[model samples]
Target chain A: MAGELDVGYVAQLARMHLTADETELFQKQLGDVLHYAEKLNEVNVEGVEPAAHGLPIFNVFREDKAKDWFTPAQALSNAPRQANNLFIVTKVVE
Target chain B: MTKRELPALSIVEVQDMLRRREVSPVEVLESLEERINTVDDKIGAYLTRDLTAAVTEAKKTDVALPLGGIPIALKDLINVEGQQCTCGSKILGGYRAPYTANAIEKLRAHGAIPFGRMNMDEFAMGSSTENSSAQLTHNPWDLSRVPGGSSGGSAAAVAADIAFGALGTDTGGSIRQPAALSGVVGFKPSYGRVSRFGLVAFASSLDQIGPLTKTVHDSALLMNAIAGHDSRDSTSLDAPVPDYAKNLGRDLKDIRIRLPKEYMIDGVDSAVKTAVTAAVKQLESLGAEIVEVSLPHTEYAVSVYYILATAEASANLARFDGVRYGHRADNITNLFDHYARTREEGFGAEVKRRIILGTYVLSSGYYDAYYLRAQKVRELIRRDFAHAFEKVDALASPTAPTPAFKLGEKTADPLQMYLADIFTIAANLAGICGISLPCGFADSESGKKLPIGLQLLGKALDEARIFQIAHAYEQSTDWHKARPKTIAEGMKRAGKAGEL
Candidate 1:
């Protein structure tokens, strides 16, 4: 059942770096979870609309108004790494 | 009042005393603080506490307000300004909430003091609090067993009398399951009933913040303070907020309660079935019509929930890439490596498992087959409840398959843990309200008394009906009044464990 999906590829897609042991462990567990989820295929969903939300809310718009919000200091207060009032991340293209 | 009696008082009782000046706010806070110091070591219900802040808030308490001086615990997932909001995950360790959640603001506006931060499954992921990286929250009834989660700490705290009432988020039975296991009242309001403005998002569509309390009346009281529309949350409903506590004592003479056939499966525990069956009979005796209903698509609830929840979770959790906030992997040479290693080290196993499953299901080739199909089936599941509602005012079922199992029993198998939420998940998927309250108790093989829960579900925005039925059931039975013995009482019997 592990052959149903590639654990390595999915982990990469999720931006998670799994070690060899983790990959092996997750492969089996994910296989079981997905296998159990295969029961969904038994239902006939022809012409059924996909429900993106539980309610029938659509196009919820609010008036564009300027309101007082969190300042830069408050926004950056929880940043793990901050420099010059800006969040610091590793350079993408150097 | 003595500190020993403080934990057992309900919100209504505490409010009455506060109104009479019989117990000051500071006295109430001190009593809970003392109780937590005494029993928290055994129960492990709180993740963090700001007693100093709570004391300050208590000093300013105005007893004239509706919820004046009531101490309520906030599940770590909900932000309280200037307090630690860990979401019970290492990824968010050392992070402080910049502002208060909408519900927290409402609680404060009504004079409810946010006393302590309760533990939960990391980001509300697993059914059991075992997935929490911070600490294991034990069942107050039996410390060896789990308290059901991701709101395990909230349920445990309320059950153990640490908090009069607490708030919990139910993405997929997180609140109700734990509440059921811990012998407390766990309510999940309709999806849009409460605003999600500052509550940490698990699965945006399914996530709802509700109350775990000692009585259904307290749940309604808490709901009155918290339920309403908030402009900050786009999905928040604009409907008129009902006084949930107003119609609580109403009779259920004309109410039609449905028993879903699919929920009464053979795999369910005999004790759970028997207790819930007896509770249903009690409902019938109280002058309600018990009608047989069929939710044929109930079997697909777990399958659909896992697919849809993980898919939504994958996207919702992508913000924890160690860029702006939360844990940052040290010694990172590049951006991609930073993101990869941070999540790897920060998240627990179950979180990673779901993230991977979510990624796989939403991937290009598998999108239509997995994510889209699950969403379509989810529609059918929602329709099943809608049709059932046309015939009955509410539905009744067992909250969990069994009483609390041993801590390590289901951890090895994720599917088994998922099955524990089999009865509670459908309500969340359908965006309806549900409650888990103590119906009866079942004895374990060792003769330890474990509490069983009976879940009552209502259609969307029909929480008042559920509350009426639950309140009626709770009033007729003494199950809600049954409390677990303190850790000291249990230790006196065994003489080996419970050394804090």
Candidate 2:
């Protein structure tokens, strides 16, 4: 029931690249893990509702009041590089 | 005090000395630094040491606050201003936090000295610290084996006596599992009991910050120091923080302890089962009654946890574009290229794998099948715990199936790594509170001994009762007095033979 999930497919999905060996290794491991998870399919769920958060669901809202805010300079002070009230980095748009 | 000698001091003893002025904060800091220098090489506990700043901070604290003058190691995820908050990742290798975590700021206001950062699984994703991009932290008990993690460094550091106590974060058993593995006391206060303002999110809904120490009393002391609501954290509960230390030594004469049948399944290591059963017998001797209970849906906990935790992680990690303070790739031409190349270069394989699985679960078409279904199952798991608690005062179980395994033993298989947290994750999934303490030692067939832990689980805001039972159990057992042979004998060999 196992098949080769190519390195390019994983890389494309993960948004990264890996060497051939790393790809082969991860492919085998991830596939094995998912197959194990599929073992859960053997269980029967009749009408059980999934529990998310512990407390009863409630809408937590604060009054819409404006408060003091950090200055652009202060907020951007720890940026590796910054200019003109913005964090500067490598060119992104081709 | 030698490296081994310091690990045995109770937090209260350290605080009392600071109050008496018999030992200056600088002296305590220096002693811990000496221990770290001598002990950490064997344990690999500390990730960053801010000695100059710590000494400066200690010098400033001429007067002790409640927990002031006590040395504690901050988990790497917490942001301490001007110190690197690596979160045990290569991506944020040199990234120094611009501001301090709200919890750290509160600790400073009360005079607690920040010793350094501890290692963890990268972004707190893995249960074992093996996923740490930095290095493996060895169990103080046996150097070849692991200390439980993603907060493994903090747990090992405290276990080795490098510091009196240390702060660690838990999301799916990071704190308790490691504490159990290392033969120390680890407590996770009720979610929202402590602020999570600066902890790097692994699974936000599941994460809670707590303490690891040598005793239940010390764990409660640190909880009193750190537990309170903060306006900065929207999720922080607005309840009053109680004086948890007051009930530490209370008698648990008639407390009803529940033994969930689901937890005592086949496949639990015989050694761990024996230790936990023995711990229950000791509790019964103290007049506590043990009752068998059922949590029928226990088998679904791990599956539900992985789906929900990874889904959240996928969303939480989207900010690391390499443009924001983390590592960046060279010659990135497009936004997609920037995200892809930077993350490719920055993140470790485990981190990337989680992101991919997380992304898949939350993807447009599969969202309902995986993510939504997991959420509903999570609700059922919580209800299961709640249903059982109605009939008992608290619940008990072995914290993990086995003690700390050797490094690289489970790293190859992610499922095997995930299984390390099987027993502890249920509490996180249910959003209840739990604590782990040394039960006894498990005798290995090879004549090596490993520590086993017994977990005490309680309902929301009932930490006082949990502490009472844990303290009572500690009072009746000598298992906690046992430390690693290396640490205990290392001090004697080094000529610091005052106490063993």
Candidate 3:
């Protein structure tokens, strides 16, 4: 909750290619949320453990056997582009 | 029964009629289609509904099953195999789910017919449905106000009598707030009570699926069909799920309901505060011992929730990068540029704002200061519940600080909108079960009677207890029996605006 928010840096990190107007607007809005969240610093949490989730969950092992799964055609059903059961995307390596 | 009359009935009533062979599933579909046709043009509660497909599926309804042939509307984020799972974002435009989610699979297996494509805030982010690029869903109580979101469509449709029951996801008050605003019964099951395998993820840790319906008993019926352990959702509790409807119709003989003074703060609307106080007094009259309690950390719940929820949301939503499915940017030769450009265009203003805020809090320099501190504070909030529940059967509070506001009331100020959910978000933060049911109505400035809700919070996996209490209160009052006056007005408005 500390430090003035740099919307440009955060948006870049977030992959939100914002326009100038969006950048200016988000800077002010995100600043307000962060400002409101400054109240968290008041609570003393010196020795408390951080809870990753609401409940404590230990990993469970499922039965190690083959099960009904999405077929290749099914997996490719919503693909923006598909060829030979493979999802097509822009070339990663030029 | 007349097709016009069927849509107004509850899930239980329709199920009884269906079981007695008084009306077939086909009739229910026709009835819903008629009602939705009459009112939905003004409400904007649905993105799409396939009557042809629904009628065909209804033809095979089996009344012997619990939800058999009963149509339960679904919030758009939930996936039914091959159905559009847009989550009200243009990013998922033209995207159909590849397979069904675990909860829907359970519901479908129990003979429930998956009905309409209910609207929502894109990715279930906003408290008001205004953020949805799909359409603005107006409150059924007043044509000019909002149906609270991100389950706006789900709540409005049920309140408007277009559907008997609905499935909505609550991550920081999405379900309960909307239900309160729309004057319907909405229950957010304790986290892990329902599986999230098929839900489009938003703030993963806080997200939960729940029911919005006409009555508490109907919520319990829908909960029974969908809630149980699923091996698919790793966080789902493997513990037993009780029949949520079994202990209903009981008096609160020795139940100790607590009143958290922190929730009765000064900022709450006088009408809402008075109504909630009366509801608590009603419970006391029913033999409940009202004990005043304190959740000292209640002041920090919203702060902790925004920090943690947005942090998780930023990561979960990173999957939508114009690659596998949904909107893909054209002429983006660069792969990285493709993700950036596509998201900016496909997502709405609110979604992007949360993502950026989320990314900020979780980013390197601020990680320990914001995210870690919030997690620790979250533990404090949870401990408050753990201690309070040790002595009480449930905690009573107003669901939202105020009744439904006009459409653009809080839209410009995002932080003000976030504070509207202050009362209900803590239950989600603590990972406990909570239900919001109609307690009374408040007169809006327009002289329209807007519904206010009474919220009951129970311990983890204690949905049955709260349902029992809520059902008793609902049975004793005529609040749930009140219907909106907007249908005829909507028809008149729709005839004129072609745009209402």
Candidate 4:
């Protein structure tokens, strides 16, 4: 599909692997999606403001304070592999 | 009681039995186990059923929790403290969550036992569960057909009697559409009604969590248990949480339901139209003033939803870099290889497709034209709903364009799958509340019985009125009582039952 972005690098950056067939399949699908997205280009935003939400979006943050949480053991219980209160994983940055 | 018979039990009935000691929590949990074991294989409704863990929890509770002894299904996207949270993809296959979602915490506090995780579309992207990339959850009524997806497993699990109710998230039609297809009640509350603290994100602005159950009253009960202002979820609503279960089954003599003319356009199946029209008549007979309205921008909802949904999904799913968590590729030649291989290995075809589409739309020089514009269209769609509410109390439409389609029928074509959600997508795009209720049934010339759902959309936070109309409708009809017999027949082809 023409004008399709080569997202291969980003997919790789995200630890995703796409086969040649999938890459090709996605290129077409993504291109079509973007083509359809071009309808958004028709909207006039000149002198119009961009709003984050239709309704007011407020930061409903809780007061910063100490709070109790489950012990590290409980949190790591579902990790496929964990060691010494940390989730074990392969090295990323060399 | 046979497990088959147990699927028909309402949450209130089950809880009442528990309160009276007529059914022990242990016995209820055991029956749920038997039901899950018996039907889940054919329906593919559950990812994991923690029989031992649920039993342990039930045994520990000498005094029943409010929802104790009541079985419930959890959508796989949410993290359960010690259960695998796959998000219906291979990438996070066998991945367990370290902490429970805040909503799960609330359910546990209310004594709800998590029966198991239900299936979903991979990363909650597809309108059908076919994208699960693990198992295809057949519609409980018709094993050969799909249970509407992303939350297909949860919908099927409840519809097939594996659980009295289930929790599912909605990005597009993940919850409501599946509920419609599966012959159950599914509600997607206004965004942030339920906390999103632990749900795997597909589209943040569009995502919501709600109940899928056998009845409207059950959904209301579950919503009351889970809906609240949670500090952990920034988008969580600070509005006062109403007792959703209050005023359920009330008279709707003054309730005005608007039938949007835009939804009844060409391409809708004849049977779906017939069923929805019949349902409208039924609603009219019960005192609802049916009015005609127009959502002029309705035609563009799917396009806007796709763009915005993919863009947000692309950004939100970036955490699975194979390094931080989930499947990682070994022997990485470099950082790029690790990312590519892990994502390739971890995510399935559908998830990857959305991620790529999202990346393209949000990429440099494309952001304003794609993401920004879609968001604007999204605002317009919401305004359309708001404008119509001035004319009526709620909007009604067919939940899907048609009944459940054959398995593998549209999996090869992503556009067809997206189109299946054409009707329900508008609700999610607008962030309004909507519920899909089994209103009627259709008989194909081949003599197959398929359930048709009618969707009731209410203004944001107006779940009470939606439940009122749905419960009233169910009382006037026996559609909810007509369970699909094919679930037992495992009868290879879709089967026919007495039609509504």
What's model 4's lDDT at B274?
Answer: 90
lDDT of 4 by residue, B1-500 (tens): 44334445789777776788776788888877876777788988888777888888888664356677676789998888778888888778767677889888888888887778888888888877888867888887777888888899998988777788999998888888999888899999987789999888888888898999887788888998899988888998888888887878688899999778888989888989998989989989999999878898888878888877877888898887764457776676776676677777778888888877777667777777767777777777777888999889888899999998888898787877888888888888777899999987777555668888899899888878888888888889878766777664432111323323
DockQ of each: 0.86, 0.49, 0.81, 0.41
Model 1: per-residue Cα lDDT over A1-94, one tens digit each: 2367988888988999999998999898889888888888889999999998777776688788899999999999999889898998888888
Best by DockQ: 1
lDDT of 3 by residue, B170-236 (tens): 9999999999999999999999999999999998888999999999999999999999999989889
Residues B1-500 of candidate 2 have per-residue lDDT tens digits of 43334445778877776788767888888877877887789999998898898888888884558887887898899988788899999889788787778788877777788788999989987867888889989988888888988889999888787878889988899999999998889998777778888878888888899999988888988888788988777778888878887887778877999768777888788889898988888898888998878887688778878878888887788877776688878876676777788888888888887776677667667677777777777777788888888888789999988988887888878988888888888888887889999998876565667889999999877888898899999988777666677665545312223222
**Alpha carbon RMSD to native, model 1:** 3.3
TM-score for each prediction? Answer: 0.97, 0.94, 0.97, 0.93
What tens digits encode model 1's per-residue C-alpha lDDT throughout B172-253? 8999999999999999999999999999998999999999999999999999999999989988999998888877888988
Model 1 CA deviation exceeding 4 Å by range: B1-3, B486-500
**lDDT of model 1, residue B112:** 94
Query: In candidate 2, what fraction of native interface contacts survive?
Result: 0.47
lDDT of each: 0.90, 0.80, 0.90, 0.79
Model 2, global lDDT: 0.80
Identify the CAPRI category of the predicted complex in candidate 2. acceptable
Each prediction's RMSD to truth: 3.3, 2.8, 3.5, 3.4
Which ranges of candidate 2 are over 4 A from the true structure?
A: A1-14, A39-49, A90-94, B1-7, B62-64, B490-500
Q: Which ten residues in a row have the lowest lDDT in candidate 2 chain B?
A: B491-500
